[model samples]
Target: MNFTGVSGQLQFDLEKNLIQPAYDVLNIGGTGFRKIGYWSNSSGLSTTEPETLYGKSFNTSTRTPHLYSVIWPGETIATPRGWVFPNNGRPLRIAVPERVSYKDFVSKDKSPPGVRGYCIDIFEAAINLLPYPVPRTYMLYGDGKRNPQYTDLVGQVALNNFDAAVGDVTITTNRTRMVDFTQPYMESGLVVVVPVKQVKSNPWAFLKPFTIEMWLVTGAFFLLVGVVVWILEHRINHEFRGPPREQLMTIFWFSFSTMFFSHRENTVSTLGRLVLIIWLFVVLIINSSYTASLTSILTVQQLTSRIEGIDSLISSNDPIGVQDGSFSWKYLVNELNIAESRLVTLKTMEDYIKALQDGPKRGGVAAIVDELPYIELFMSATKCAFRTVGQEFTKSGWGFAFQRDSPLAVDLSTAILQLSENGDLQKIHNKWLRSSECSMQLNEMDADRLSLTSFWGLFLICGIACFIALAVFFCRILLQYRRFSPETVEGDVEEIELPPRSGRRSLRTASFKNLMDFVDKKEIEIKHMLKRKSSDNKQEASPSSDGKSHSPS
Candidate 1:
């Protein structure tokens, strides 16, 4: 059979020959990853070459599963005796499961530490992160699907499980619950996903320091207020240095006119004008810093942790959230000896990410999460993502899970250690270290939270707020202690009532409003009557003064 020079046939033959190897490589991505080496020349990851390989799917439910085999290099094939490697070299082929090998085409996870497939690793690592002496864990088991048996579990009943059960369980109910939730573990609660009808206002942004717009408004308001006060009180048409009754009338007129005539006058003193300018500065500059601090627009919190380390999270009474069934969730509720009520378990990675952003149940959350890569995945999808710090709250050993408490746990750990000892762990780690979601950065929230520095921003924010409040109170005290009224000190138009703003709603205000309404109505009626009389007079008069009056026909 001379096969030569047939282009169509040749191409077909080439493709046919390539198909098996390609399929094998696609299935045995782990083996191909090894052959490809640890670092890709482009991405700097050996196994995760092209980066997207880890997220690829098999397109079919995989069966071969890339069963791991520990082998020696260069099998010494005797005619009959069987496999052997030379020089006692341990040539290993870790048959990574196609569903879980980070390089496998069927794997969907970007981070191998917390994904459902990664939980076994996390469990192992978290166990190791603790101070030995494993707690006899009584795990609450569920595969995340609805359990027909727990039909009675609804709202507070399901939520109350947190109190009744000894550990964390993910919640899915949406109706309001009377029971309190711990931090989220596996799922976020309900969401209202609707397109914004209009551009929405920033949430509580007013709590932030003054914006440039606000600063401008503040400057204008203060300047305008001060100038109006200076003009009406200091340089008005009325006589000053006088007694009570006349002074009240002058103040009333000033109070009324100054609102509109703020910019109309030029009688304000230089010192008074300077004071207005200073007030503008305070409004513009001082409040801007205040607003920024209050709103927390700065990502300085990202640079550090809220609690710092795993130890802090483990030790604190603070409620912690975890993606249910995750290593962090397991460790905190089990090994760390945190109460079940202290753990909030969410159902999905998305919910867990959201729970982290939602923060603590008691004003703040202390969470245990996969240290870096897991957080990076969240930042890849959303802004204002959270972080973990302080010695990786728990280190997780990445592994494919089997049915609970299976002997595969130990076997897999042994296999993983074997791979680690032979540098496969480094290879895997290096591969993941380059993905954008994995590589961006990490917030050692705990480390930073506990560090002398991260707490400093909070200290400063609180300190400044306290200082301002104290200053305001102290200034008011000095003013109050003296017989001088606020009307004199700031040239305020309103009379200083001896009582607090809370003294009463002021029936006088209602009476004054009613009196004004009556006067306005009477004035309108008088004008109408006068117009009618004038018309009648024009119809009846012959002459007035030096003019003849015309009569209506």
Candidate 2:
């Protein structure tokens, strides 16, 4: 159907078959509505405009009504034909959940016969923002003995037992199917809460400074340094020269003692001393890091939860707690595939604390699973004895509930968004849920042990230094071998020691291994000759200058 006039044409589908009509209309406000002139039915009975549609006229009568006056942005004008209450301005009946899981949300005072809480404050604030007054009375929904089910409270509104329901009502898909929910005032989601315990002492706590791979790498480096130093020093240094078994034992002893700077053996070769220098530097860093990590472990108090996340709870046979009538129970049983027998229903904040503290073995739950708002409220109210584990498993929000398609939902949602933008929401939240105890931070150092990554740079530097020294040592050995070879021997290069006639003859037929042995023997002989010359000099100096030489003292 279509209507054309001096005003723009209004087109709509008569059969509702089009994907989209010329206009989409909602009854809440006229800020977006356009006037397409007027219509009249001369023989029909009169009808008043709906209370929701702000600018459009729904009235029909025998006489023609005036055309709609344009309503501009930021302006609201009264309709010539407006709705009036049928029952003499009776207050709208609003249901407030009684004995809610957390009393901070909503609580009815019997002595004063009134209801007040964080939710009540927000509801009043939102209603005040609406253009017109919404007179309403709070009727408690459940008996004081037990907390009321939120779904039941919302159901009453669907059945028209109440004009609306308020107080920490969650906006969920199933609930929204029966009622409309305003924009969420409080962002929320499901979280797991578990009691935090001090880490227990372990007999092998000493090994925590380094991971197993780090320990193995460090040990390998130690043995490598020892062997390299022995190779460089054994020919010249008496301390390094020994029987095969003694030399092998010395390698381990010298390597392990370098950690404490207590090795008795001394390096005589420059290469041996250079290797020790780099090894000692690397050991210093490893020791310092190990000490710092071990000190933090021993001196600091650390808190942790046994339950890491939803998966841990699902796999365990232990009982888990949920608010008595919350959707969490259904999510755990149905969505997570957990056994119903493993769930424990908790009715109050005290119940949550008691159940968690007692633990699953003592007829209580190992953890409490609930929405963030309720969990945060519980955390703020108590000492820092519990903590949340992992991310929220489910996403949802808290909003006020109204009968299906109620026009008030849109305006109320706008008011809530305004509150959020203007900072009133934060102030309200702080007034109820903020606590100093919740400010304490967890110690991350407790769980992080040292790994090879932390000291890889030091290891790299030491390894490079050893390789460079070995390269120099190998080059000198190659130069000596070339100089002694009969064909390569040059007249300008003076030999330090001549090979025996038989050894020289053997060298002509010697393999690479035999040549290495000949070089080793020559170096040892040179060291011995130097030592004997030093001993002769000392003996000559020791003799007295008298004609008769006394025994050398």
Candidate 3:
């Protein structure tokens, strides 16, 4: 009954003597004899029984019992029972469920007609990491009419129907009770998939980068800079000094045109040039940043959605989609507290698309919630028809399934860990799922837009500079007006001293009139001086003429 020393032994004698003379046989493990079965060349295999076979020798002089045991290469001794069993040498039966999209996971068109996909490639790569080779055969489960649920696929391993169930089989706590799984090779989680509703282009989309307040502030600064430049240069710079209408046009033209660095006015005063320099730099920065931000906003479509995240979908009381029999269904029902009445069960990518297109008002789901792999696959195929919203929730991963206590699980897990670290897993994923059509959409969704908040400090700096320049211009105008006031007169003109009773009224009335009178007096004195100089020149010329006439005689 005990197989103590049979570990190293190649073969053991089943029985010593018999009429037929049966020879040596191999043991399955080093455990006590449990039962035996018969393997015959003609009659076919028979049931295993405890007793051995007996043969008649005619005289019945010798008697022997037929012993039988199953054996293969790479068999190891089972602990406690000391049973010798081959873990890898035998062909492993792998169960694959029938799914059209998932057919790539295990296809019949291949040379051997078996499994191959993101999951299958990962499984084979992990197995290859071991020192020995593993021979395997794939048995597809489910009727051809419908794809099997993940539960039914994993159940095959639990029922001892196959060594493992390999596919996009998700690992969950409920399934863990029935079967053991290796370390997760693919990270999986639920995501909200909504129709990629195109955002209508705003006629004012160009103005979105900066807020209304910012735009208003920017416009005000533009005008302020223009008016300050005109005030400082109007008297000296002829280009700026013109008729009222022409001057008004010049102010605006110079201010706005500076945005494009195409102004015509030339600043003459030192103060005017300083202001212009600062203003020009500010305009350059503003224009450059505005162009950059505006370009980004237009090139990268700004997508907007009613359902920003899972919470929004729930709060809106809109119908939600759950892939039939996916873990997301249970997650929605239990974790999210979504009512069954609101949940719409979807079975395929087409179903997801149809539900989203139908919209919430027409008995369609507002959003579809499913695993990330399926979502990615769906998005890639549809080319931006739908987009995944919200952060992934209820984290889980996909892994190969095995019966509880299977010895291969540990080794397979170890191999998988090695593959993951070596980057083989990512390479497999890329081979199966990578696509370029949706790359722009995916990247655009992830990119952030420029907001007014990003450039508020720059705008503030420009605004402050413009306001200071305006204040300086106004102060200069006031100083010039004071310099021409009558109170500072120094010629022999008598100062009119008002009578005591009329002093207040006289001061108030005469202030403006006296200022005008001073301007008139200055003009008259300039004309008189010119006349006196002209007469003196004429007299000197006449005397010179007389002298020349006498010299000629």
Candidate 4:
């Protein structure tokens, strides 16, 4: 018989008539098998010469050697790729786990609708990514009311009882050993769920508004403003000059009183007034912020947790709640070394709430340990009553299960990857996982109240103002010292030099020291002269041992 192909014409004869190779020829064929022998191309099949194979040729010189050996047309011995249901139109059996807790991920009930959830939506969307349609029907893997063991659901696929298993099945090393899993559509990890309560009032609660660093910085600025004010005012402002102890008290009183806008002493110098203006502005901002923060702390109810994380639960003799038939029970025992006595099996979200509310003392668990998705769903329903403490500890992903080395795993995995890239996966996730009615509750943190970083710029402005004022004040003092020398200010006297005590003093240093001494003496004389004038005014205002008042004349 003759056959035509893109290469050229070829002829086939019965396998029995073909000359066999010199080596042993194994006759392992049935009646339907035939062999091709001759080619009429420009270059015929060749064993030694490469040109004969590349260039077309008619092999008239010798019978064409067997170019290749293959089963005759219309005889297929290899199994086909993909799901090939027997011609009876049987749909693919997809096993969906009946989850008691977090039914939003997978729910199976007989009330009209059978199977539905986040996992279901993701699976259907992924199947659509394939070029061909997959006829599938969801079969519940457990009795409709209880949580199903995921291992059993996966095992059915391995045993050929089901075509595939879907719905929140975590991929593990042991499960993978039995069946292949597609790339995960949802991330999974364990989280600690605990009940929350309002914080109680205490004596130290007043100090909760500002961090320690913030308080220290504020106190240091109070002293800084006081020092800067006295430096600028002491020379000319009579209120600033008094006994050393009195002057110290005045600096303290003036700086703090500014907070209430009740400082009695007035600034006399122009630069002193500028410094006060900047300080008052900074004080206003600080006062308003502190007032608002402290008011919120006192008026609002704060939420806190005594159990910080898994470590806290392990150290205590409290019972820990785990979802019944979950992977958490084994993880808590084997990986975390938690005692079985501390484990409590919770089958529903209501069970979780009751266990946490009763507490360990009242026959309840201290905390519920479960996967992140389940805990998040519970939190959404309860809203503000519970919170997840600490980070996710264990790591895994939810994936679909298939028979071992099934080609469907690769195609399904590719589809999931496409869904993730094009944002279809997130759309499915938001449709089921996110709740529009639940308002996310955040813990009121002390870090949010107030910090030094918030007001550093204002403080910088005030500091710069004080620095400029002090610079001007010092410049005036230096000018006065140079114009009125010590010899001229006091009575003229012969100069006498004393030897330095330890460090040798230069002429410039000695002159500066003498000028400072002269300034101090002049300041003292001014104070005494003012005191004498005050006394004279008092004496004139009064009568000498008589009721009549006396004038200076």
Best by TM-score: 3
Rank candidates by TM-score, best first.
3, 2, 4, 1
Model 2 earns a TM-score of 0.64
All-Cα superposition RMSD per candidate:
26.6, 13.9, 14.0, 13.4
Report RMSD for candidate 2. Answer: 13.9
Q: Which ranges in model 1 have alpha carbons more than 4 Å from their true place?
A: 1-90, 93-270, 286-330, 340-368, 378-553
How well does candidate 3 score on lDDT at residue 100? Answer: 52
Tens digits of per-residue lDDT for model 2, 244-283 = 8999999999999999989999998898898899899899
Backbone collisions counted per model: 45, 0, 4, 7
Q: Please report the candidate that would top lDDT against the real structure.
A: 4
Q: Model 3, range 189-282, lDDT digits (tens) per residue?
A: 8888887644467798677666666677778778888987887776567788657799899989998998889987788877788788888887
Question: What is the alpha-carbon lDDT for the whole of candidate 2?
Answer: 0.75
Q: Between prediction 1 and prediction 2, which has the larger TM-score?
A: 2
For each candidate in turn, the TM-score is: 0.28, 0.64, 0.68, 0.63
Residue 392's C-alpha lDDT in candidate 3?
88
- CA lDDT of 33 in candidate 1? 40
lDDT of each: 0.37, 0.75, 0.69, 0.76
In TM-score terms, candidate 4 sits at 0.63
